[model samples]
Target: MSTEAVAVSAVSDAQQHTPSAPAQEKTVEKVNLLGMSRPQMEKFFEDMGEKKFRAGQVMKWIHQYFVTDFSEMTNISGKLREKLEKICKIKAPEVVHKNFSKDGTRKWVFRVGDGEGSLVETVLIPAEDKTGSRKTLCISSQVGCALDCSFCSTGKQGFQRDLTQAEIIGQLWMANYSYMEDVPIADRERSVTNVVMMGMGEPLLNYDAVLNSMRIMLDDFAYGMSKRRVTLSTSGVVPKIDQLAEDIDVALAISLHATNNELRNELVPINKKYPLEQLIAACQRYIKKDGNESARKHVTIEYVMLDGVNDKPEHAQEMIKLLKDLPSKINLIPFNPFPHAPYGRSSRNRIISFQKTLSDAGFVCTIRQTRGDDIDAACGQLVGQVADRTRRAEQWKKKIAQSNEIMRSQG
Candidate 1:
């Protein structure tokens, strides 16, 4: 079947199997306040006949103080707190599983809803600088990916649905609390310094929820992270790239795995629609200066180095020509292996040669060090427990098992 046909079938199957609400009486669910933007919170308060400032006070309590219980919000009036308790909820996902790598990398598997396989994974990588330790949290926007990039394990899981704003930001909420549990309250600010929406799915595909979560990340009453510190990576979603720049100016990273359209079309299926030329043009537009000097940014070109695939010295020369006019840096990622993966990580000598080619051509290039490999939390290796509607997971498992059996027989 064609990809479009499969996607349509999956959507239909999901709707058919979804449980419907009773027709006699409707239950009103309390709003989750964890991911609400300042403006959204203000409007929420306005509906409750409260002043706009009440939203800010409550926001600081939830995000800054990490207080979910309304009674603990000392600054809020008792009557107002009572009202909020009845109408709003600060819900974070339950951490179903946690794993820590020897290199200080931590991964959390969170259950978003009460479904059988509603799990999503988030990773926290710790780094040190001149000041102190810094942690970067990688969060997911969807349960699985619709764009089945050949190189990504998450894509092999197939699409489920887009996460709500609450679910997306809740990952960070839980990560921050977990990382700072032992730190003094005054020193908690160093827990999560940066965030990347490059975890399980294509963030641009779930635009509104992702953007709303980003707003909460940048809010002074919440995480208060700089726009530069938050990044949203896309696998060449052209139109959304334009929309994202207009909506918010967070740093942009493109998953440009291949230098040419033929290879990218095979690796990143979305390239068939947007192609490489349109994608490069979009990247150029994203970094264009409007009025703010801070907005003049450089896009990070992410290239996963697969053995014998798009990692040759000639490929690097082509990349230099392709990105010469754009303000960007190359991030060479070594392919992280999984069961039944079709590619191998490029040898160290091959990677160094590729990097040298780009560097000699006057382009800034940095190789990304692989982390959390032992715990399956590295780049392109996140495959959370998704109740896949497309049945792609079952097919992949069968294929891998068969391949293994055949190899054993031959040996």
Candidate 2:
């Protein structure tokens, strides 16, 4: 059997044998085929005593045609379709709430699990470039994040479980399906041109699901998106970065919020475990391939500009020295604030000055425009209702409350 087949079968067998809860909690769950890649699906069919080609037909139905019902697949025989309907499903997450920004950014709050608190947000951001207009869907990997990056609101919510493969790819499926409501599949143009795994959680933490989902995104039977157009952002997970280089090839972005070791350690706690030196070394290795488009592919250094935090001229100088060897383009993101957030957005002048330093220093740096802030769908602002498993949310709330009390008392 192929590697994908073995892995897929192992996952299927493991889930099948898992213990069920009591009658009150127990519910019939069908295999959701939404997340499976082509090779995995081929293996699934081979295991079921069906032709492997059935996998491609089913993939086109689910991803390309956006047909959720097995009955709608006219090409498959009635008997096989009936069997698939009985044992499997093509379900995506339920979208509970949706918001459209005046700037054409769309946000959806999806219920990924059974409870009310299982919500995760996905955003579609439209941009115009030299080529043409493009829409990028930001995908969430986990329900909530464990990495407590000081400025991000999602981190304030604390850790929750990693999202399954279905939940991960469902974001793209739903985003694209939204446009096909009125138009027929043949007439439908791709609504989302690119995808960025930069939403609610640290992506590298949820490795397997994320990798398979991304492979689906790149697969011709599915999204057929270019590997470069699909970017996966991580908060400096070093080992995964190396492992990722081996498993698949896609654009990688580092959440390098701060430049130096001390500031980065304070801002992104993951920095303490995987320091700037280690992360930089890994990045250098990641972009080392030759004689391909990936050879010219530079790692994106995502820096969120916080007022008096990491937006200083000295910080820009630090970034220059740090990224001197690595081929990277710096993206300066203006901080987006949320309730009781510790940091403020860097002033326009300060951000401009910082960008100028890098631009002049020969680093291709661009400031990220703050978008969908009205709907709280902007970067670092996605805070879906998380049933925080860590109790870190409670601690964070208490800390914020105390800070407010101290200020009020001083007044």
Best by TM-score: 2
- Per-residue alpha-carbon lDDT of model 2 for 1-411, expressed as tens digits? 632343345347423212323447534356678888888888778887789999999988888888899998899999989877766778899988888999999998888777564768899999999869889999999877889888877887776678888888889999998988788765765578899999989999989889889999999888889888999999999999888888888998999999899999999999999999999999988887433366237999999999998988899999999999998999999987776677899999999999999999999999998888788886435453433456666787788899989999999
How do the predictions measure up, each by TM-score? Answer: 0.88, 0.91
RMSD to the true structure for each prediction, in A, is 7.2, 3.7
C-alpha local distance difference test of each model: 0.80, 0.83
Q: Cα RMSD for candidate 1?
A: 7.2
- lDDT at 221 for candidate 1? 85
> C-alpha displacement of 238 in model 2, angstroms?
0.4
User: Candidate 2 at 355: error in angstroms?
Assistant: 0.5
* The candidate that achieves the highest lDDT relative to the unseen native structure: 2
Candidate 1 residue lDDT tens string, 1-411: 432232233223222122323435543345667777788778666655678898888888777767788988888889977776765678888887888999989998877766665767899998887757778898999988999888888887787888878789888888878856776544555368899999988999999889989999999989899887898999999999998878887899999999999999999999999999999999888888364346346899899999999998778877988898898888999998876787899999999899988988888898988888788886435443433456776787788789889999999
Summed over model 2, clashes come to: 0
Q: Model 1, stretches more than 4 Å misplaced?
A: 1-27, 130-132, 182-190, 379-390, 397-411
